[model samples]
Target: MDMSWPHQSQPLPRRRALAAATGLAAGILLPTRTSRAAASGPTQASALNAAASYANPVIWQDFADIDVIRVGTTYYASASTMHYSPGAPVLRSYDLVNWEIAGHSVPVLDFGAKYDLNGARGYVRGIWASSLAYRPSNRTFYWLGQIDFARTYVYTATAVEGPWNRLTTISTPYYDAGLLVDSDDTLYVAYGNTTISVAQLSPDGRSQVRTQQVFTAPPSVGTLEGSRFYKINGQYYIFLTRPANGQYILKSSGGPFGPYTMRQVLLDLRGPIPGGGVPHQGGLVQTPSGAWYYMAFVDAYPGGRMPVLAPVSWSPDGWPVVQLVNGTWGSSYPSPAVPVPPRPVTPMTGVDTFDGTTLKPRWEWNHNPDNTKWSVGNGLTLRTATVTNDLYWARDTLTHRVQGPTSTATVQLDHSAMRDGDRAGLALLRDSSAWIGLERDGGVTRVVMVDGLTMDGNWNTTGTGTEVASAPVSGGRVWLRATADIRPGAARPGTFSYSTDGTTFTRLGPVFSMGNDWRFFMGYRFALFNHATQALGGAVRITRFELSVP
Candidate 1:
């Protein structure tokens, strides 16, 4: 018995409301951005219990423009990370509700020079709306996406935690393309905006065999994109998102590219978050026992777009539907079939002692990093990678996604070695960045909070950052913390605090407002940086970074 309903124009039932309210009590509705580990709904033990239900936006964090697939008993999802290096984040899960960082397809943003942050920036131009597919016969996974709308790049790996190799590039861009490795192993891609097209690829999925325009959406459906390909029960289905509000399906019964028929699959505004955007633009996956689910994202920025899972049912004629409760999308659902494998630990939150040879998959650089400038052994040491007046252009600035609704990130670093004109600290990085850290000048160190940095349409730093607060400090090691209030439609401020002695902390500067504009794309990220304003050679040793839900 699958308990599900289609969208109808009616109010939610009291019982559904009661269930959501109950979960909010346990999860506490979060606060703002943490790191990534802030769990929602319930504890993992209870969350994975056979009878326990899970909430929508199943795994909260900026896993936007996601495409998911199942391999054996495990599920993996890849999402957009515009401009952030080690792009195309891949998240893995067993139960779908418990997700963890599972490496990235692009170890570094190697598309061009700007991605290196050498002298220019690629803030809103990197891997996004990518396609992920697995060819079980070959024990390989394929990842493809268009960059800056110029051309599509292809990558392949034997394992999810990969040494992914860039296979080749297609001269023509397959915008928001969806890859389908058909039953015969022939490759096809369904892509484009408003006017949708399908292209067949060579055996290895590197070049195109042929391409054709398949279906063009009506003007009333809004702009269509985020096309995902699936062949269900013999029908070749192309699922697309109107992105701002709804989802639709194009079905071709005879061939991969054909005269197809389209239908409205989902058009609803109600979701888990109050005043949040509709669920749109994510992929679907199936369970071993044959249950189907649609994984979509709801726009809840400045926290960034987060993924949600919804049950799907097939119509007698074979169209797919997104389940609803009391005429609208439900906030929670009965747990999908639980996996037999052990649950994976959550990523990003808690203490990162920097005690390993490599940073966890959750960490990404502000752009392509200068590998020679950083090292990790006992503690993460960052050498000033560039000489710049602004942090935006500095190389090797590492960032982690800011957790949603509400969260906090704290850093403890040894700044004794910081040379003159060196600045090292923690920041909520966005178009309008704000941070608190140690700034060294003339061999003297002081804690400072800087904001008021301005950027133009081109993402250039039009105005230099201003120091809002400063304090002389006497310590070899200092702790800096940033708490963000990124709940959509709220105050959305990022606050800062500092502690010289590891025991106590005091507020440093006035709350700084974070941005929610789409041009900036990637949401507020917690950044750990050590950059030089005059010359290189200075460095900072970060011993601990603790992120938590407050």
Candidate 2:
């Protein structure tokens, strides 16, 4: 595919005929009313309100490749964090419908200097398909992930919110592997892409003892990977994701290494919801009351693969049934049968004062950050680095997932420390991305907007961005904002705006198209980036960032 940003001959129509065709006016394409929710604090609602009932996308944000485990009444979830620092983000929940970030497995994925963004890059290739498990023997939690070009690593911690320790590295590939500790205290791993395999691990969980091919899917199955192993009521089960189909299960009455029978557990291909694609790849958990539920994800674009919760049960013949109402996935389901604690409603997006001693759990870096170049005190200070125009390769680009349906983010940037050839702004980042920011050239600074695409077929390399608009700025500080309207039936591209007084705002540039590239395997993220094109002393200080959603 052509990676360069496609140039448009004319600005986007102020009120496109397409909007009228869709029965939506151009004026309603973006948020017209200011959000009443507090911009500086978390939103408040009865915690039991959401817990009393919940939706399919239990977690509305991007928490993909999820593997969840239940210990007692508490549930813990782990997800893939490719190329993002603090890889293998762990989340905790009581009802499985609500979740909050607990901590991370690796503080930074520094397997090689490339992860640190020194010379090489790790885009689309850091940690993939991690398996999280709780070992009853030692009362320790384990996280395992496969790193491309590197081997698989096993991380261990006594608590889910952890000071995790890198226990060991296994030489075996184990692509999208899952771990299981049997009642006999023996450990086994299940993994494969086309042909599935099982292996016995040493008693200490450091090395493989033996291996064998257990099962293989037919060629008709498309894109089958991400195996999750489980042993329920004396039967061994393996759940594999077939994008062409839904989630399929392999069951064996005998043992881990099995003569297993294959059956489709979640084949409601009618789409994730009423008019969506099939939900794929996640783990299953049982509540304390012995109720089973499956947690999976749908390939939702511009917001990434979002998690969905579904009720489940076993058939008399020992097959797993992924429950669907009537003939489609329901938008809302009865909440999980767990204690619904009276806690503050967890906001998917929020404001960051940058006054805390540590970065918020919601914040993540594009790649492993260079700690020496950034600091957080009165605000976030990002010292510019000599990186190319490819924002994907730029260091210290702090980011969070863009909220779905509709959402808006605004940041106040102090560019007084910025030098010539420095660009500091807010961006919507994916394999394809666009930004609205301040660009300093020599002694003159300009408010600029640019958009670019990263060619996935060509090893995911980004081309120089195409400038859409620019205007000179006289001040050292400015506020930049982006409004994303990703609601179903709404336009895919979002609008960019700028403000000098922090109240009134003016729109800029054409509506930039949001990318749905599958290669990046993620949704667009709202990012804060500051990089230098010439020399390195440019710095940008962000005093405040506020995110609100409707």
> Considering every candidate listed, which one attains the maximal lDDT?
1
lDDT of 2 by residue, 1-550 (tens): 4434323211123112222122211221111111111122122232223223456667667788889988755789888888888888888876686677888887788788778787787777887887998887899998887788457788899987778999988898788988887777788889988799998889998988998999989877666689999887678999999863478899998899999988877664554443245788999877655567788887777677778887776666766676665555656555554544445224556788799777877788988887888999899999986556777678899998787656899999999999888888999887778899998887889998888746566445647688899877777789999987654333577789998889998899999878655677767788999998888988999999998875
What's the distance in Å from true for residue 318, model 1?
0.9
Worst 10-residue stretch by lDDT in candidate 2? Answer: 28-37
Off by over 4 Å in 1: 1-50
lDDT of candidates 1 onward, in order: 0.81, 0.76
Highest-scoring model, TM-score: 1
Candidate 1 accuracy as lDDT: 0.81
| RMSD for each of the candidates | 7.9, 11.2
* lDDT (Cα, tens digit) per residue for candidate 1, span 1-550: 3223322111123113234343221222112221111222223342223445566667668888889988766789999998998989888876776678888998888888999986568988998798999986688999999998889999999988899989999987999999988877888999999999999998877798899999988977868999999876667889899977898889988889877999988886577776678988988777654566789998888888888887776666777767776656678766665444453345556788888789988899988999999999778999999988788888889998887668899888999889999989998888888899999998899999999776787998886589999998997999999998778875788999999887799999999988777667678889999999988999999998887875
